[model samples]
Target chain A: MHNQIFEKYTKADKSSLIPLLQEVQAIYGYLPEDALTDVSEYVKLPLSRVYGVATFYNQFRMSPLGENVIRVCRGTACHVKNSSNLLFALEDALNIKAGETTRDKKFTIELVNCIGACSIAPVITVNDDYFGRITTKDIPSIVKKYAGKTKTNGVTVTEEAV
Target chain B: MVELTINKIKVKAEDNMTILDAAKSVGITVPTLCHLKDLVPSGACRICSVEVEGFRNLVPSCAYPVSEGLVVETNSPRVRRARKTIVELLVEDHPQDCLVCVRNKNCELQDLAERYSLREHRFHGESKEHSIDISSASMERDPGKCILCGRCVRVCNEVQKIGAIDFTNRGFKSIVTTPYDKGLNVSDCILCVQCIVVCPTAALRERSSMKEVSSALESRTKFAVAQIAPAVRATLGEEYHLPLGTDVTGKLVTGLKRLGFKKVFDTNFAADLTIWEEANELIHRLVNNEPVPMFTSCCPGWVKFLEHNYPDLIQHLSSCKSPHEMEGAVLKTYYAKKLGISPKDVFVVSIMPCTVKKFEASRPELTEEKLQDVDAVLTTRELVRFFNVAGIDFADLNDSEFDNPLGESTGAAAIFGTSGGVMEAALRTAYFTLTGENLETMELNAVRGTDGVKETIIKIGDKELHVAVVNGIGNVREILDQVREGRSHYQFVEVMACPGGCINGGGQPIHQKTDKVLQRMRALYEIDKKMLKRRSHENESIKTLYKEFFIEPGSHVSHEILHTHYHSRKK
Candidate 1:
């Protein structure tokens, strides 16, 4: 918990809560639980209120970011194509719940609403690459590809797989 | 005053008043679920939606300001339809098991449902499955039953200033929960249970010890003993539909006896003992120039609050356990020895006005030789349930006397039920301890009433003592900030977590009636006035206890049995 970000605002200035939290999240990638306590003291707001505000907004995240972000669309079009099964399979394979980063920060899984690609229907995206009409069997191979990537490795494959 | 016509009746109300207040002034009942008096109205429930003459949509009477010439129909056909639909929607997501709920007939939501004549289950929505949180020793939370009225959240944040729980997530997924959605025991919750008092549904309640107590009473090996707190006497009558502030001490004793308790003792006896020890402790501190502004440790909620928020100031809180805990300790030790029974075999059940006492009883520090002083705690409301379960006629019961020795108490102990009671009671004894003379005026009017914070200056001989009494925990911050900055001038301070003290505690009868706390305060003072001994030092039983076992006030033995230490609960 560095005091550098906190130096931007006066102590107990409640109006600075959202901006302070955004700054903290930007520096840490996600709002760390320990840092939230420090943020509470800095803003003179209760920790529960701080945590409440953090959880209310979709912009802020509580857990650390993984090297690769996996988004599973649970939109109406994807629902009819059994996209939930793919989500479950990914959760089992990665051993992490949706909206949680893996312990090693290798992969983070999130359940998103509409990604506006109904033609791709049951879609699961890894980084910027999209997998269309994927099934449960495809989850293991998708996870394997991401798990092999190093921290500095960049995704060059932009082709959408079906 | 702003003139408004409510339900075709002309009413004059203050310009700043809301539509709800204007209607209320004309005796027109406009029902509200989310509107809490004295707090900022959120208008979340919209149960008080009223038809205004010019408004396109029905405005919430609770939040809508009253203006001149405003025509408001509190129960118009459209307003009724909207209110019914809101109730239907609320009940659709709520559980249908009202028969087994803790609130049952006493529930405000149930009353609203009946008032709206909601006979049909109009709407069916997918209910959110929430696991009941019973991790805390004091209270339980069932989010499944919550209507999101924000009453509990408002009271927790606004009144107590302890935001242990808040609305988390967004839209339909929102819930009032602790930080990280963790158990309250692990969170910064002080187990005050103020949230329980404000909750309209069975969403929040005191954790029951009735079963534990019943089983203990049935056990032949266990000698069940009951101790009733000062506040319980003044407030418990409300459950039996008796007059408000009726001191049912005698009836309470008789009822406890009928429930199979071997002896019924008064927590007031220990309250006197607390004063004896606390006054001496204050004098010691004042003379030696020790920590000034020594806080009263009687309210477990306040003690836990200080421990969590101001761990560095724990030294300033008196080490004395609360009155009931003190009585329980004495019962398990001196009384048990007198009866030739082991402390573990003597099961002490405390009947208190506080929900926090349930948590306080479970503290390891309040135990000796691995045996907790109080086995279980039953709140005033729980005691009502106990009586109902036993089929005991509470109002008709013959008035009986409290068992001797531990049952005896002075008038100083009786006033411990209200705010400033402890300070007044302690000052009475402390004045005597310092100057060997009782206060000329027994009533400390400065400390009395429903004010959040009270301050008084007393001149005792050559010594002028300054003191402050804080009722609501939220109001203590200003004084505490001063103390932290070394600007506090008071020699003594008292803080109770609940506003207006134990008389309006979370465990007392839940009602929206005004002046109930004031009536209870008056009744406690009346009890003090009628007592034979007005000072704690004048109690003969306390004197006997001191002579027989504890030796004297602030003795090593007294310190060991009666006093307890606090640790920081910061996370």
Candidate 2:
């Protein structure tokens, strides 16, 4: 599947590079190990520097992404509202600590500071959407929403248990 | 001349003129607090910040010079916001006692606050609370009210030539104080009171003489006589909304008359008398070879400067009280005898243009028979306040002359108000008295005008006389420094604490940002130019007084009354 995506990505148009790279990372869950080198040479940057730039930013990843990104706000207002407890719950339920993708690659959890909707805090963001007044108990269902979703062609598939 | 555009308006200004001056030349008003005309511009206050097109930050327009083709904005939104923020920050920690402050209505900071429409402090923070230090008998220092503008420090160091006070510490902890926070009276301070005059806030103020004068006025039993200093006439008009350097001598006499004084005597008469005694003493010193260099004693600031800083040179200073003090002493004794009144019942009040005169008048050494020479010394500002209280319209008052005997003065007496004036006045009498030949020109143009220290060599008969004139105390320091190094070539020197001399003394009427000290000094010289008799020796009144009363200059009676001694002070 990785080879197939690499071949198709090589033939892909240069004008669509940013979006295609983003799309490929979205489909496969993250930029694959070889994608950076291939993209670097295609764009004429040294592979090492490109990898360095990719790793420097928190937004980029070399491994496949989980099915969902769960961001818990630890902003001043949210931190006071027990957001830490919700982060712990999500960490325990996923069986992987905060900042790590789940074993089944279904969810990735992270904490952010003050996302500006501080008025509705104890807030969490799943991808682009925000969930306010979140509790520890809501972690399972939040992860379950993207667990059984169909995988697109040239995308990674990983098995999940319960 | 350099042409510069300020706020899109092009203006021509002389070379070496600052952008603020250029802006002012073209009627572009920029507010400032620490910029005084006679003193060096320290630019401590950032209120005059203006936007120069290429500069990274707002620059102080008062200190920044204009360059060709430079575009400047005086009142742009950015400049206004920066100025407002700077003022707000200053006001945040500033004492909020404008109504009760001594400079209440006259304060530049308060006026700026009104101009900026600052109704509230947006950035209130911890204010440094300092106790009032009134250790000096002459002036009071309220650190609680100091804006830390360094005008006092500059005036003390640069203008007065005395470095008694300086900015100690750094940043927010900085303060203007004597060394080791010692009281001014304990420091090598000369008690010039020039600091009090230049201070923007009420931080430094002259000790109050209002109550003393008020009580004197209320006590109808004593016969009160007021003497006006020559400089007072040159600057007193400013108190009555008169222009800078307005010669309101006639009106000032009228106002004093309206203030209910029994007689308004002219200190100029005594100024002429001072020249006679001082010149005679200088000639005597030169002839007897007693103290080769004789310093003029007409300026109390210079006398105090000698006592405090150059104590070793005290002998070099002529033992003469200032004209004001001399007039005060004479008023109580000679005038009292003439009127057949007891000296105890005669009140001698002097209206002077110097705050230091207040300190001078109260000097222990100036007392005669345990009675103070001058009972009260009112600055020109205080006299104006007195006039206002008495509802006297100085401008509308009918022109009147000072009373006889003591009222008549020569042009030499008139020029005493300006820098180098006393020296010129003295020279006119001294050269003639020594050679018995009249001076070719009454105007001694070389010693006249507003240079910091003017040195000249004149051919007095067969002798080449060396003379140095130091107007501001700041200039005095340089000359003294040279003297201390044994490099002083001057046989005679005249030093006035204030720049441009007593006409610009600290006790003179306050010049609201627009008028400056140098302008007032020039106005004094102009008045001197218009006078008929510019030579002190030529004044008929002075000659008559010499023959009738004192017998001669430096006579035993004159020495007992007019000459004074000074003491060395500890730091």
For model 2, how does the per-residue alpha-carbon lDDT over B1-571 read when each residue is reduced to its tens digit? 8777888898888888899889888787899888877455778788889999888998998888777887899999998888888778877778888777768888877877888899876886789887777777678888778888888877766655456777755567667776546576766677777787778878888877888888887797888889988888877777667677777888888888888898999999999889989998998898898875688888887787778668888888889888988887887777788889988888889888777777777789998788899998888778877887788777898889889889988878888888888988888888889889877877677787778778888788889999989867777766777777888788999888777788777787665544456667677677777888877887798777777778988899888888899888622
- What candidate 2 gets wrong by more than 4 Å, as runs, is A1-162, B1-5, B9-19, B36-43, B52-56, B63-71, B121-123, B481-487, B512-519, B526-532
lDDT of 1 by residue, A1-162 (tens): 658888878655689899999999998889998889989988989888999999999889987889999989999999999999988999999999999998998999988898888887788888877788777878888889879985444544333455
Q: Please name the candidate that would achieve the greatest TM-score relative to the true structure.
A: 1
Candidate 1 CAPRI category: high
List the candidate 1 regions with Cα displacement exceeding 4 Å.
Answer: A72-105, A111-124, A130-147, A151-162
Worst 10 residues of 1 chain B by lDDT: B120-129
lDDT of 1 by residue, B359-463 (tens): 999999999778998999999998998899899999999899999799999999999989999999999989988887779998899999888889999999977
